[model samples]
Target: MKNYFLLLICMILLSCKKENKKNFDESIAAKLYNKAKVFRNSNVSDSAFIYYNLAKNAYLERKDSLGVGKSLVNMAILQHNKQDYYGSIETSLEANNFLRKIDDSTTRSTLASSFNNMGICSSYLYEFENSILFYNQALKYVNIPSNKYLYYNNLGDVLITLGKYPEAQKNLSIALQTKDSLKYATFINNMARAKYYENPNYNPLPEFYKALKIRQDNNDLQGQNSSYATLSIYFFDKDKIKALDYAKKMLEVAVKNNSKEDQLQALQKIINLDKENYLENFKKFQALNDSIQIARSKAKNQFAVVRYDVEKIQREKAEKEIEGLQKNFGIGILLIILIGGLFLYRKRKKRLEQEKELEVKNTQLKMSKKVHDVVANGIYQVMTKIENQEHFNKDEALDELEFVYEKSRDISYEKTDNQGEEKDFSEKISETVSSFKNDEVNTYLAGNDSGTWKHLSTKNKEEVYQIIRELLVNMKKHSKATIVSFRFERENDLIRIFYTDNGIGISGDVIYKNGLSSTVSRIETINGEIIFDTKIEKGLKITISFPAS
Candidate 1:
């Protein structure tokens, strides 16, 4: 009985120690995180990163996911400020993974923040589509007014980059409605930029000045630098003096903040706008930019090494967890392997079946094209000849119809090769034009004797033959004309075909329906160009150009 009582006392003591350690670690992590936030706000990125990482390690040791996620958020922002965009994205995504595992209002807000960081990083990397996607995702979970300001402002900026000015303006306006001074400055500045891009002649200077004034009053150094930078760019082509003034101000602010990147940008603008001092400024800008780039590269490498160390630690932890799972369930592991193999085999079989089906569909599409060009065109020509003839022969009609029917039935049939068979390719083109000749239209052909036809491949010639034949058929059926002309010429490496008709042209803009749309698709397939012109008073004019090869 005494031994049992002693054992219970021992367990109680251990539990108390564990609880005390948890409370102590939590307090230390919270203090570290608060210090990191202060450092981050001051733009002391290196100090912020050190405290954030320290807090992150403490949180990890205590198994506090929320603390870890918050620390990662600060770390990611530090990396982003350092211009380590790829590393920022990685850290933000890791934060998101942790924050998402705990479903709560606070965690959801943290996840939204992670997504916002991801959007900013993506925008910096020029992945506009992914940036927009991440911004929208952030917006979806952003319930806080402060977070809304961020989401809407960022969304507007990205939309501006995408050239969706109206949408950008709308989003920026929404962000402004939140009535936050800092947000107001940012949104107005972005709105000014959007308006400037929407119309070059429109003056966005008033809005720019408003944002600048607000930022200056708030003592926002970063915002002031941004305003100066934008103002310099805004006045660059309009007023050189104002541009140089703003550039100088930007340089002043950047130097005060010790922001080398901003200094480089300001110097570049000054060099561009200050024509009198351009040569001197150019040398200064070149020297400063080179030095900054080297420093930045070194800093980026250091940050990347830190991130790699963090990743390695996480990977080690993951491997340990996986090892535990493997040891705990040997039979389950064997079953999983068998199931995975079966799943892969089935997936492969399904993919092969899909591929086979796609092949068949593609073949059918090709066959349909053949039928439209060969059988359908043949029938249309025969009908036109019959309509124009004084008398129609029944045997000739039957023979033509039977030939088309047979061609339609043969699924394995190949298109008749016209290579070497047509001793004169131009003669074949001339014959195609003559087939459309009627009593009402006087058809003419020019440049048909050019040796340009020899330069085109057999496939190209066949496509040309079909295209010209289709055009002629359309003219015959729809064009009520007195004259039609076909002219083919070669300019260097391009074959140009110009067709003009004296027919009563259709009214207004030409609407390409079935036949013309198909013609366009065929021309596009051969990487050709086609232009059509039709008016009430003028007859239709069509020009086609394609490479000889």
Candidate 2:
């Protein structure tokens, strides 16, 4: 009786385990689908596609037809967004096949969406009859008012393309009656387009303004710019001043949005409108248009390469599985041995040379920063002091010093000519600080010239000089500082420097530029650390420490 109980308990546990796993997989698939929808609504097309694929694969493993169908339709929409019309059609058909096999009332909406996407994709490819068929099928399954109106709009667009004006107008009129304000502008614009096609000489200015007002009020930048371009073209042959005004507005919108394609289109129209300067404007327009085309081509190629890499990874995984089953180990092993030897041989030689070159380049850049901070700021301050003088003497020694300092800035990879000379470390810091001090700010130094400066290396001294000089220059340019303090301390063989300024402190998001960046690198090169306390309101505080050399 104990043995029978044990067998029955094992069977029950096994069944429960499978049930739990199925529930887990179903939940994960549902979550992924929901997340994909969110991303889709936010216009994150690539991310939406990725999550949809993940959900589809999970649903396929669980044999969940409804989940798989929904994922496929979402992916199809993403493909449509990417302008992959054929791929969109294929994905939508696959989704429809899955949805059709499952006879569930809840799946009707998903089926409707899939068929609607198929219709849109087909229409984009100019397959009007196929588009109409898909639209009709979507209408049969669509239960919601919003989707029903969308189908009507899509059908109207295809009918307009097919030159069936009466049918297009009828469908568009029906779509306009739906109280969905989000789509109101688009429907209005489509009706205007149909009207334009119906009558060649019709002025669609009122219709264009009606759509533009809605789009602008909603802050729909792309829609607003599109309306500007349409109005510009509509007025191009009728009223030159109005055409130029709209074209200029379109250009402004396009530039603001960084839409190079629309900018190119607007520029072309502007050149046509401004006939007096046609040649000049046309040249500029052509150059920008060509550049935009090249950039777009490069982006398309990059996307293709990314897709190829993903496909390659999937192919390699399948190949690995096949090889594992076959146990085809000899060829791979031989190739690995040969490739490994060649790789190591090339890698060692190249890496050593590259490392040497990088080290030299870094040193040059560090020296450049030091020169810019120390010599450049000192000379600029002296020039400012001289310029602010009530009495001027051109023959003074200070003028010669200024000239020499200006000349020193031209060198390629060395600190200022006087930088390496042995001088009192604290005195040098004081001099650098005083250069940035004007009537607006008072500078003070403490413990800088004390015995703690004695244990520092020449390199350390130079780096310290550069770092302090950079801080002063930054304070002068940005800080609006009233008072500055410099404090030096020694603790356990660590030379610590503290700097503070009563300036408008940096915000949390300020990025360090070349001067501060190089200071950090220089300190790190000498095995030191620096920290900033910009969170302090209305003041900047910094602490830097390096071991005494």
Candidate 3:
């Protein structure tokens, strides 16, 4: 009997756990979205916006991109209705990021709706060009004919505002083909306005009256306000009395519809046309305009607050979940940390030993480079002169040998030898290249002026000198050419050196070896590039370029 009681308790506990898991079921997001629709239909815009935002987050948590796009579209529409045009555009753009261009009808519809809302918001903000582009995009995604007509009408309206009357008429004509009577009225009214704007002599009153009659029959207060405003504007210059009467009718309709913006518009026209009550109408206009501004500001703030609150709740919920996970895995995490700590200690010890070995190797390489540059290359330059020049001065060669001796000695003491800095760098470069010239090789020099090396630093000059010397040495050893040319020029902030030799050009890849690697390294230290032209059939051409400073 006791065993049976324990089994019953276990079964009850399992059932409760299963019930709790149902709270996060995917259907919850759909329910929230439907609830938001109900609120929106009931005219509770703030509540609707909040619920749509919530639904978006729930869909995001489920990784449902399409659902998130749909929710954001509704949120944007709510913002648009609240006169938050900028915020509505931003939400619509974000919704577009989540929507895909697929064959799914629902996804395509949601995408189309998002773009259409953006177009409407852009129109409200007076960004007519951007509004046209967004409307065209909406048309591309709109599978339903009614939606296509709506986008076409919107595009035509903006095009008319931009004075593209012919284009506007084309789009409006397409929209007028729709079977929907209300849409036809909107399209025809827009087409008439386009024609009148294009040709001031065109009479749009007939079409305007027809649209007004249809809107009145349908009891569309918003459409009636549009028609009344249009009629008032049409009669304003022609007959002030008729314009005033129509403006008065517009104000009545706007007030009945509770649209502050339309009321403000009508009041402005009345103040302009009705001289008998100018001050009275002006006061009403100012008060209505102020109230509309305040309401729009408050709506923008409320939307921000709703989004902030939702994000805050989500963040706090995430933090709590993290905290619970941390608690649940506390011991496991502690053990992992202990193992990681031991592993890091061993790894750090090995890294330190490796770093020390690398430091020693780097020191050896530095000394080897100094020897090669100061001693070996110095001797090679002297040898080349001795072998090439008919009148090689013994005293000058001895002096060069003595300078190399001093530089070599300084390497052990780690002292810099500034002997190369005693002469103008251009003269030094000319003398160095000339030393490599003899009866066998004819060397030509151009653009090696003093101003070419004026802005070069002492270290950079040294690197350039060494690189030129290395190239000449490589030429002497490898290329059996007779003619060699060294051209130096300063173009803007860059110093370029072009070397050519009429010798057996390097075939295939120019292998970097036999001091050539060090030449490349020295060029890199001064932020320079060297290109060896192996494509030449008869001669070698090397170009070197580096910043002058």
Q: How well does each candidate superpose onto the true structure, as a TM-score?
A: 0.53, 0.49, 0.57
Select the stronger candidate by lDDT from 1 and 2: 1
TM-score of 2: 0.49
Top candidate by lDDT? 3
Evaluated with TM-score, which candidate comes out highest? 3
Q: Weakest 10 consecutive residues, lDDT, candidate 2?
A: 406-415
Candidate 2 positional error at 147, Å: 1.9
Steric clashes per prediction: 0, 0, 0
- Per-residue accuracy of model 1 over 1-549 as CA lDDT, tens digit each: 134533432342223323477777778778878887997899777666766876787688788898899899878877887777777899998888778778788887888888899999888665667999999999988879988987999999988866678999999888888678877898899998888787778788899999999999998888999999888877775788998999999999999988877887788677556756644664565456445434444455556544444443444444455555666677786757755865686588668657755765565566556656765676666666656886675335434543443344232224243655445577566655654553234577888874768657778888887788777666655676657888889888898899898876654345485246778878998899998876536677888999988
lDDT at residue 411 of model 2 (Cα atoms): 30
Model 2 residue 183 CA deviation (Å) reads 1.7
Q: C-alpha displacement of 261 in model 1, angstroms?
A: 1.8
Query: 205-285, model 3: which lDDT tens digit per residue?
Result: 899999999999999999999999989988876899999999999999999999888897788678667766644664565
By TM-score, the candidates rank as: 3, 1, 2
